[model samples]
Target chain A: MESIRKLSFQTSQFLSFVSKNQILLMSLLFVSMIFFSLLAITFGSYGLSIVDFLLGKTSDIQNTVLTEIRLPRVILSGLAGASLGISGAALQGLFRNPLADPGLIGVSAGAALGATLMIVLGGDIFSQYSLGVFFIPLAAIAGSSLVILMLYFMTKGFGYEGVTYMLLVGIAINAIAGVGIGILTYISSDSELRSLTFWTMGSFGGVTWPLLIPVILIIALAIIIMIPYSRQLDLLQLGEPEAFRLGVDVQKLKYTIILTCAASVGASVALSGMIGFVGLIVPHLTRLLGGVNHNYVLPGSALMGAALMIIADLIARIIIQPAELPIGLITSAIGSPFFLWLIFKIKKL
Target chain B: MTISAKSISLELGGKKILDNISMDVRPGEILSIIGPNGAGKTSLLNVLSGNIKSHNGNVSYNNTPLESISIQERAYIRSVMSQFQSIAFDYSVEDILQMGWLDHSHKDIKEDLSAFQNRVIKECDMENLIHQKFNTLSGGEQRRVHFARTLLQLWQPANTKDQNYLLLDEPFSNLDLVHKVKMMESIKAKASSGTGILMILHDLNLAYSFSNKILLLKNGRVIEQGETKKMLSARLLARAYETFISIDENPINIRYY
Candidate 1:
């Protein structure tokens, strides 16, 4: 009896410790994200001092570069990273499978296919208008939603027996999408081909405030919709029968979360092209720090994701001066080794 | 409070798992469904608990149709402790207990949960195991801790009109003799305190000894059911299991010889 009291007391103390420390960590990370964003915006091929920019007394060249190129790229990277991380964490919880990610389920591949198709087919027609940029994202979102819808039905196709079939079908669709991407790359002209390759590799080179709206809005909406269902997700982790016993409408919750993930992944991919590991890695990190509670995992992942992208962007700038490396490469290089170490550490726990 | 499933039948994958099984339990009573392997004891428990749907007939609690109630509403009244639960992550025993209390419909019980938890942990002899990760515990220890969670579920005071339903599927399968007796006693005390429980038991002695009512199942059918002592007989046991068995009443020991 005394031991149980002690245990309960200890658990509360631990939770309190995390709660207090989390706020401090979030504040620190937030300040750092802002600092990195300013650094990324102001430092580039041409230097613009923060004081000069704030004073609105920038040189024409520096102003054009800051307003046109750097700011958009920095802000977009942060938004894209947040979206990928939040969506990945949410999907992991939704499926109760840690390996589950938007990339693995073919959502990103579908979005990429949609973008590739837009690039190849809309060249002359799209080049005529400013609507061209929005067109790719629209196509990507549409394509991702379509694929997710198809997978949803395929999973529900067998009426509860279809669940096991969902992941298998997801793998098949992902493989098919990979082939489609390969074929598209095979037929493109040099410049378009190189641009496509760079885009596929991922870049924040042309990111602007105009691109930020949809990405942030969709991610924000998905996160908002998902938070209220956090407790339901907790019940879900107990396994389906127990979840059902606890009054969660399993089918409805599953569909809603998957659609949310698809929408967020589609938006981020359409904007950023493709950034790997953020979605898969952030959730594991959140789980490590906060346990498996979705309430903490979802929001916590968003902050961590935002910070990670900014830091990655900062590293990309310093690595090669006057020449830039893709921020995506930095994340993968950093994320892969960290993820491997995480796997080993988790095994021990 | 009363929970009853009438003529419940379940079929899955073109195979009929349960056929025309009907059972009932009232508040302050225990019902033990006893049967051999594949006899649909677990299926019946599932049907009553709303974890699995019945193809035919209906389940009603306090005379209200079970299907009309939302899952959340049903959850407030019923909690099931299955045969096994496995998860890749780790959760402390106290954390699992909190999960149990968190599911209760009453909003006011949140503060009282810690006190009730202390009571349950003492009852289940889980004092030392409270901080241990659920997955790290032995099969028997996990069962006991889960049983403690189950007790918390059963002891919740449901809304006045709602009936509390407890479902245990082979809950004793992993326990040693001592823990089995301890679990049964805890369950009996909860029943007396107002939880209506339906459990599947393989041991006839435990079933006959603790249950106020016994359900004899054979081939997914309720072959016989009544007062525990009156209907528990060697003939019923042999017929239900389709095996030869002997019941010696002199010292009340049952053997297969």
Candidate 2:
């Protein structure tokens, strides 16, 4: 019993030690993610041997499933989650609103509308070409870019009023995108409606290596772009006028935030459809776990977001075996209640 | 050296908010801008701090055009504490204070960061509240935290070098008497240590007591500007404020009814 108590004390001590150093904490998260992902791959419907897979002795079918299907799906979900998480954190800091998220700002909705329109109208034209995978994602990016550009032009003032305009314009654009998506949904064919439903209720089942690479690159690029602005975002939390006075080029920072967040969020929506709540909840969770300093919060949110997405995807895939639930359904089921709990917890604090 | 503005005019929606207004603040001195409601005190601050880009005039900081300096470079020259700040997220007071630290807020780039952080916390009298959540703090405590953070930008471990500045807008609004006095003493200390100070003050008594130079403004135009003792009078204040006022020469006090 004494030994067990000492062991437990040591574990807690180690945990505290790791938590204090954010770089160490994030590195641990990253390593655990890799380990957990490899472990997760051994699960699922197909009978696969972890030992054989590790030893490179797995069968052809196992290799195909692991490399082409499972790996891409896992990676895509993780990337999407990271994108949403960092974008949420950046937007919240940029707009100086705790509730700011990619979904709220119309990036996802606009991406959905653009893809849905492309699917309903140009579905036959793109699918015939080998480069068809690029079309929908490109269209989605275009739609989100339009929204961000509109926001940029509309919020052409300095200080708090500019931030307020960004949020208001985001809401207006979100509503318009919603209407457009509704109209397109009304007009789509049976097959198109199937894809539309897939978009509405997000899934990670069908993604392949070809489709996943561009998205991973885009999200990786966007996150890299966001890293440099972490300090500026911290200053922005004080409000724009003060931020500018303290030597932040508010206009340039705003432009960078809008572009990078919109681009990453658009790419994620293009691939994963609509995975809500990760972006909104991840940053808040990161802040609660550590502190509100963006240097740590940005990477911490990304790592935690990827971990959460991996787990959510694992549950979504394994719970029903061969037949699967939409990733969005599971996330919403989990996220909404957790968010409500978080709200109450924060209110009490 | 001085932060000087020359014939600055600001117009918004075809209305002249500031009509050819000019003022100067020298290092190691406190310049108080006193006026009533809607008198363009905050607008002038906005212009001076480079927070407003549309103003038509020249603002030079330490002999360089304010517009020519990069935003980040400007923090090395001045710190501004504007009124009515509402933070969006909950962060520790320590984190909020850290926001004031620029690329190099310290004199020596290699100086230990936490040393200055500790000094500013103690200076602002926020030692007890430094670890608490900023949003959870009371209005006055939050004000102290912001003042501490604002001071952190121009944070000098001992004395400020020549040419840096502190611009405050109603910094004492929410503080109790104790904190007000504490903050007042610190601001006074900062001014004495070679930091030029420009502040918009509501408390005429406090302004009259500490201000070395006074600018009396009425409806965006300068009514009077000179040494505080000459520029500040019951008659000038009464005319500028459009109200009756009284002053006592003993120990420097002003009373408004």
Candidate 3:
């Protein structure tokens, strides 16, 4: 009787835990993301107040900082971080392996190759045109899509027997794309090379309103497309045969999810070139806090990703003072060690 | 409802694993497939559950081609539990059960799974093992928990018209005598409660004692299949397993090890 009573109490506690945690944690993180975003907008060359922003009493200094400089940077960083995190979670779940990430699987490299090639080749064609930046994002998306399509067809034809081979092939593809990027670097002019190098290192240096729209739209659309897939993602962790037995169309689901991850990562990488470890770290942290269920993992990762990137950017701006450090350097400096620790821990287990 | 397969065959890695095997399972009855190691028993279960496509012939559920049915509909009809589960994670038993409730509604899942889990734990004498991590459980304990997971998959809304079926591959292999008997009794109870059960067993005596029917497979072909009592004679058992046994039939049923 005592045991029965204790079991019942524990069950009630678990149900309550899931309920309270979902509502409480989600709102807490969402609000923190907004707060940090606003904080990020407020701290650049000039400080602005919430009253001044709301009342539209904008001075030249405040307007320039808020509109031209910090606002777009914060918004773009938020979108890029969210996309990377959610896409990472999706790819990891789809592969049923925790180490799988969109950037690691050559999606970022493929997009980088496409963008570099476009800048090199399309520079000549669009020399007279003002909208030269347009073709780079477009080519990046197309190139990443092409690589995803190639990988998908290769796996389909290989008959799903070799999963480890897929990972190895992804690394090989990234290495080949790296060679392509090197060749593009050799022929480019010094000014263009400097811009490419900064972009490759990843920065929120240039933020215009027009660039922000597509970034926000694509990331928002990706998140929306991903929400309904959480339940299927949960079913997939049981492995492919078991997932198939449980009524998931395993091949079709894999293709759809990989394509989605590829597209989202491609778009984000095009906007903010190769921001590392937001995807890897955010999803794992969400799992630790929210449990393994993707319903919570997806949204939680997005919020945490945005907040982490915003905070990282804040530190990057303040640490150097007047001249900003590359945000990627900060993320990698923090993320790489933690990621290595995770790999070791998993291996030990 | 009934499931019937005719002349099913499988060739893997340029080897014939199963060839031209035939079997049937009736609704609300326990069918046991008894065979030795390397006899393709698990592979046969995989074929029945549609994990692998057959090189020849077809399987049907109530005369409908099993392959023609949607995966969701097929899942609603059957659940399978293999002998080995290698998830290798630190998860609570309740978390594992929640995963089993994937095809179930949130409203009824908690109530139904907890109730079923309670009944299974009581029946398997596994009440103490409930809160333990799955990787921490003993082999026998893990088997019972996996059985609970499979049972959860078998659960459905009361009004659904589909016939529920279970395919188990050597569920009693690692269990002690008491737990083994209890599991057999639970399977028997499921049959009585209107679920079809097909299990592969290595022990012919257990098959004869618990099941309504016995299927003796040798080299991917059925040597004999009929009502358990009439089909499990010493001659047939000896031929199926290639082992001599002294039959000492007494008031209490017994078979010498």
Off by over 4 Å in 1: A1-28, A55-64, A122-135, A146-175, A185-194, A338-349, B103-109, B154-161, B249-257
What is candidate 1's lDDT per residue for A97-166, written digit by digit as tens? 6655666567777887787777677777545676555676777777787777787677652233444565
Better of 2 and 3 by TM-score: 2
Model no. 3, DockQ: 0.32
- Residue B50 CA displacement from its true place in model 1, Å: 1.7
Q: What is the TM-score of chain B in candidate 1?
A: 0.91
- How well is each residue in A1-349 modelled by candidate 3, as lDDT tens digits? 0111111111232232244576678788899999999888777655677569779898777777777778888887887788888888887777666776666667778888887787777756544666554566667777777776776676663233445665676788788887887778777873443355555557776767776676666668778877667766766666666767677777777766766676677777776787767788888888887676677788888898888888788777877788888887887887889879978987886
The best candidate by lDDT is: 2
Residues A1-349 of candidate 2: C-alpha lDDT, one tens digit per residue: 0111111111222112112577777887788678767756777887566689789998899999888888888888788888888888887787676666777567787887777777777867765888777777778888887776766567653245666566576678777876777777777664643455567768877887777887887789989988777777887888778777777777888878887887888888887887767778899888877777777788888888888888788888889888888888887887778768866775775
Model 3 Cα lDDT, one tens digit per residue, B105-151: 33565666667767766876767777777768788877888787777
Candidate 3 or 1, higher lDDT = 3
Per-residue lDDT, model 2, residue A96, is 74
Kindly report which residue stretches of model 3 are placed more than 4 angstroms away from their true locations once superposed.
A1-19, A124-135, A142-171, A190-196, B83-85, B88-90, B102-127, B243-257
Q: DockQ of every model listed?
A: 0.33, 0.33, 0.32
DockQ for candidate 2: 0.33
What share of the reference contacts survives in each candidate? Answer: 0.35, 0.57, 0.24
Ranking by lDDT: 2, 3, 1
